[model samples]
Target chain A: MGFRSLKTKLLLAASLLVISSGVALSLLVSDQYSKSLIDSARHQAENLALSLAIESADKVLTHDLVALQKSLDHQMKSNRSLAYLFVVRDGQVLAHTFQKNFPQELLDANTVISEDGGNEQTIVSTTGERFIDIARPIFQGKAGLLRLGISEKSLERQVDELRMKMGLITLFILLTAIAGSLFLVKRITGPLGELARSVENIKQGSWDVKIRVSGRDEVTILAKSLINMAARLKHYTQRLENQKLELERAHNQTRIFCEIVRELGTV
Target chain B: MLFSITSIKPIAIFRVSLIIITALSNIGCSDHEQSKVVNFSNTITLEKPDTKQRGDKQLRVAIGAMVSPRESISIYQELLDYLGEKLGKEIVLEQRKTYSEINELLGKSEVDFAFVCSGPYVVGKEKYGLELLAAPEVNGSHFYNAYLIVNKDSRFNTIEDLRSKTFALTDPDSNTGKLAPIGWLKKIGEKPETFFGSLIYTYSHDNSILAVSRGFVDGASVDGLIWAYFNKTNPDLTSNTRVILKSENYGTPPVVATRQMSKSMKEAIKRALLGMRDDKRGAEILDRLMINRFVPAKDDWYNSIRDVIESAGVSMEPQDGLSKSEN
Candidate 1:
């Protein structure tokens, strides 16, 4: 394939630069915002879990599973961000709000805590949906875990908004850059185009044609050099023309003299 | 040939430099986005621990009144200077016209200390780690009431009589002005939008009170402390105003410090305030402020305020908290 024009190359470069930077900025802002949102959500989830754990502490101490289920439901309904709540005891699921099974990774025995509350962990399903799960340990006769599951939709929404804003800004930058590049290339190359036309005229024997050097750029310098060269060639050609005329005049005179000498000598 | 060579140097230099710059810029462009992402994330992590500690030295403090109000600014400046002298540091007091501005400042940790109404302190404590240092004693008690005021000539006698009339809320985040009225409305199975013909946030208790007295709004809720202050100092505003309803007593506005402050500094600040009402020099400033005393306080004084926030269905989570930390 033929190489692209310099203008095309420069424009492509500018566009790539703008897009990459914009994408990076968007990703950065989104990531920061997402992490903060997640942390906030985690803290909120922890607080919710603490409240739920405290509210059901008496029932949990008595090992009343039924009352625990009702309290979890009540708490989940009160918070719109909450997706599900599950109570686990002795590495077995005692109750869960959703019919879908909890991920085994989150239910790992080592992941479960028996004291000092617990930490939140994120899980992504095979379909690429994300969730933040906060697990708090309920200690009574037996160690139980109270887990609050919150959807990542809110964070995702925020990230999407940032991405959209960045995308628009990138598009604006790319368009301006491409337009500017084209305008600059045309402006700088205009003198070169004029120089080419003047050279063509010189080849057609129009040596007297004057070339103008209007700019301080390289193209103007090239025009000035070409004009000087044309002037020198014209000077040298004029000298050669004078020498030819002188030789012709001398030949004519010599012919006349030869005829006169021949006639006088014959007489 | 020598002339040509000399003439060509500048062109060659110019062309080479342009090519170099364009190439370098293009190369840099490719990685620019990724670097921004990396940098922002790094900043979040690096700055998290220092977020609370960053502006500690400057001592950003806000007063809950218009900065242009001569009386409010004078009282606030007096308090700040007094505190500054006790702490042996220069104090910068920020003035916010609305309760929301004070809340936002406190929430962002932009202000280290604030003299905010009981309502904003309650809402901010749960979201941002706000600790009560002292409560202002006026009229011999550390408590204030919210008065529902109407024009003196208005026929409205009770809260129910003001239905379908325009009402002015001091601020959306205000406790006594917005939350308390909403609570009363809720008890009667009505909402602000359903009960009032129109509602607007005046952004200040003084402005809301003025709006009610001027007949721009049919009624408004104001702090009794402010009403008393105007009654004693600027009676012209109160000449056309009369209280029609009153809310139960709630703790008065308090001086609050961020939870991030050091124990020693917190103690020094509390000592400075508690002694202010007793010291002859400090008492002079407090007397001009119409403050009777300053008493030691705790976090529990704001429980009623928390109850109002909880009842209002406002969530306390910082929208950017987790995402910023992760980045």
Candidate 2:
């Protein structure tokens, strides 16, 4: 709301620019970070699932069913991000790492890739948490599928952390820019305020009103202009006062002469 | 009017300056409170090589030597490639020369699946937790014989004739090569270590044939399928030997998987194998490998071979405890 000076208005405009751009940059960076986190996490999960599938192939062939179950359970314990795991053999549920509420949909799908086998999909857990379901074929499906569910929460957590950091950085940049602009505005507009203060004195014909002009910049130039204008007004006022004094003297002489002429005529 | 004209005081100039300073300070303070320096670097985006990225996972397979490593690859590489194609994963062939090595690989679960002899199948299933995947049916039978052969000129007519001569065995884990010979020796109140003057293992049926053909050993035991394979591919080796003894037919060697394999994967593999003979590429590879087609096998089908091995009760354990060179 302040149009106090051109300098002040310009400073306000610069502050607005800095804030808007900072916010825009923060949002753009946050979005990119979220996408990157999700993509990389899913890829890492895929690599791990495939390795587990390969390891389980011989164990399944050897009728070492307990080994696979125990392995899945052990992995789940160490990896908190691992939400669930199941082993299905001969179209029957053999073992799983789930505590309860097993997803029957996973088993029903068979996920059997006839020509090409490995597959992954997204799923929502019973507790309303999101997860990525990865399936790998053991012995190329000569045996069965090793299904694993990984939580997406960890990915989100990382993205959240990144966003917070970005927000802080944006705020920092914004404030720094605003402070810088305001400081510049004060330096440029200082002389204007000084001139305004002495303006009344210059208008009342007090020629002694002298403003302290600092620096050899635009402010100084404006001060010199104001000083010249005040000097001209003082000169014109002095001339007018002298003219009025002369006119008063002339009028008094005329009144005295008229009175003497009238007295002589009456005698 | 001139008296009323008063200049702005110095106090008003101070107020304007104070406002500007306060605004700048406020901006600075708020910025300090809100702005935090953050490093925007990460190490999460490395690239993977195309070769290493095969199917994004590696599945290992072992082919226990029915022959030498070179021959095994030549014979089974096509089938493994086909299987890999069907499974949509990379299949790495783990080649080991001796049946015991294959058994060890199975026991360690280092090998995902294997094509192994019937002799080693029982041993691995008992000791390494191997489950049968499928067996090859060659020439309309899912069975194989153990051939006891002698040089064409040798006067060896029966098992007793070679009692005091040097003999060659194929592999310790071989049903036909080691167990069959032991079965005969036990039946005659003798054993391989005591009955023969010297015993050497060739580690392959064809290698044993080469030993027997040149009279390096007076006699040897070999697989019937291998004998036929040699006969069809290279008749010179087979023509030089005569069958002095033949053991009863036993179930053929099978492709076995581990117990932890998923049912869907098992189903897919079984389906691919069963349908192999129907496909031209698969059939051609089967012919080159001297196999008719793969058929589903159950664990109980090899009971007769198991009985023969147990009946021998003779130590077929490796003499030097050294596996043959993979070369």
Candidate 3:
């Protein structure tokens, strides 16, 4: 391809850089936010699970199943993020807040109580939705364990919001960069455009062609130099035309004198 | 550059369109409905051990709750203070509504000592090795009975007349409120649950009395000493209640310490309690508690209460509360 205009090259380079950086920034921010969102959700889930475990221990010890069920129902009602809560004893579910029987998979005695009661795991519900399960051992199995399930729906919403915000920010920066780049390209290309027009006028035999670009930059200086060179070329062409006219007149005089001298010799 | 403004002009639209596309894609994601997760039990927070050692590690003690925390604190405040002064350790008092809770607390060695009923003492000793520290001598009496009470307006005169009517019991681990009734039921060739229309657990002996007086229940079983003390000092709450039946005398509750207590600490507490009758401050505390002195604890003193529990044929069996479904 023919060489692209200076303005086109500069504009493409600046735009590419700005757009790529914005995209990169948006991706970085989105990743960081998703991670923090998950971490925050997990932290909250762990805390809530531990709370449920300790609170239900006494009721389980006293065999207050009705009270335990009532309190569990209340907690579930109050907090929508909670998916399920249960108290397990002797490898059996003593009480649970699930509408159905306890999940049989969770009934496996393999529930490992993580240190700090943060034993969390991701589970897929029968409906295929993702959830976080937090299991806390109740006083070393003196009674049972308290298990809580937190839905990922809230975390999904948070991540979406973060992504939207990041998108808006990137767009704002990209738009601003594009607008500023147009103004800068115009500043450099405006004078160059004027210089090209002046050079065209000189080629078309207008000797008084002058470029009037108003700037102190290199483009304006190039315009000024082009105007000076055009003026000198016009002056030299007028002098050469005068000299050719004079030489034609001198040759005609010499021819007429030779014709008169031949007529005198014949007489 | 200005000549082909239109060719390059569409890029503005393209750039805006790309931004719009990105923004829309991000904003398109919305919160969706989640599946319902059923929960079964209440959640409680687990507290971790503090890295910073407590400046004043208290010798925690739980007092008997035949009375309210206020009254129990009053009755044992001076004695606990005297014990604390003698032991040279800060005293922390805890109280639970049920003897079962206290028993478990002592069983788990969460507290140093507990003033609990004779029934709890024996049961805990059998289960958790609880040791008797000392027994309080109230009016020079080391024994008391279970009082079966009814509202004053009731026409029933004896335990036999309360047939098929609702009755309240205190803690399952209570001697006067639970074991005595069970023993009486056993002697009459009846079951406690079937004898009463419904057996309600009031959790505390005082709560049982309140339940009966408030007409929430037809009758209740409580400690005779607690009822007598209330009958004298707190007439308003007990004016409508009367003891309809009383069981054979049994030993009063003893100040028992968990087996985990150090020998020196136990001896220091025993010495402080036994010497309370000699000190002016201690004597004043004893007078307020309505006790003459504290005598040494004996496992034999509670043998009669154990006999009552054994006679009642009470079985503390662990069971799954939920009934399984069989197809």
Cα TM-score per model: 0.43, 0.49, 0.47
CA deviation > 4 Å runs, candidate 3: A1-267, B1-57, B68-71, B316-327
Best by TM-score: 2
TM-score of 3: 0.47
lDDT of 3 by residue, B1-327 (tens): 456542344356457646754664454244443333322233333222122232355788886556654556545677788888877888866666567778888988777898888778888899999988888887678988899899999997888888888888776677897788888888889877778777777666667778888998899889888887777778877889988889987888888988888998899888888998998988887877777888997788788887876776775421123121100
Off by over 4 Å in 1: A1-267, B1-57, B66-71, B312-327
Docking class of 1: incorrect
Q: Write the per-residue lDDT of candidate 1 for residues B47-109, one digit (tens) a residue.
A: 211133434456667776521233455446677888898888767655554566677777776
Model 1 complex DockQ against the native: 0.02
Tell me the TM-score of candidate 2's A chain.
0.66
- Ten consecutive residues with minimal summed lDDT in candidate 2 chain A? A107-116
True contacts kept of each: 0.00, 0.00, 0.00
lDDT of 3: 0.74
lDDT digits (tens) for residues A1-267 of candidate 1 = 122444444545555656656655666666677677877988898888877766654444333457667877777778889977877654556666754444454454224444775766765555566677777876431336777778888778987887788779878877887788778877765566677777898898878756666867777788888889888888888888899899999999999999999999999
